[model samples]
Target: MNNSVWNVTSNSNLDTLALSHSTVDFASHGSTAGTFATLNVENLSGNSTFIMRADVVGEGNGV
Candidate 1:
């Protein structure tokens, strides 16, 4: 028999939030028109589903 204890946690909560003003000028200068991502699931077994999502917040009207 083996007795072990481990603790894992995450602290990623934002305390305050503020959006950019309307007059602020911001643009996506990089090449962000078409983008794609891939994942290798060879080791994943049993009942599993791949979930992909994106949380995008466009700052001002230029983004």
Candidate 2:
């Protein structure tokens, strides 16, 4: 499986509540046998909050 990932960060500290959103899309070449996907977050510190909402909309054998 091929992996394509990205990361985003803020230069300065956030004093107020910050709203952020991210979207990741994965595609399996021509052959669509069995595929696995995952998402991970690392190094969370200070008075920070992390909320992840995933909305998967697709049409295929396994979506």
lDDT of each: 0.28, 0.33
Candidate 2 ranges beyond 4 A from true positions: 1-22, 28-31, 42-63
Per-model root-mean-square deviation over C-alphas: 18.7, 12.5
Give model 1's TM-score versus the native structure: 0.21
Alpha carbon lDDT of residue 13, candidate 1? 32
lDDT of 1 by residue, 10-52 (tens): 2223333222221211122223543334333233332322233
Q: 1-63 in candidate 2: lDDT tens per residue?
A: 113222222122333322234323333222243443443434333333333333455745576
**Reference-based TM-score of each model:** 0.21, 0.22
Give candidate 1 regions above 4 Å deviation. Answer: 1-33, 51-63
Best by lDDT: 2
Q: Which TM-score value belongs to model 2?
A: 0.22
Model 2 residue 2 lDDT? 17
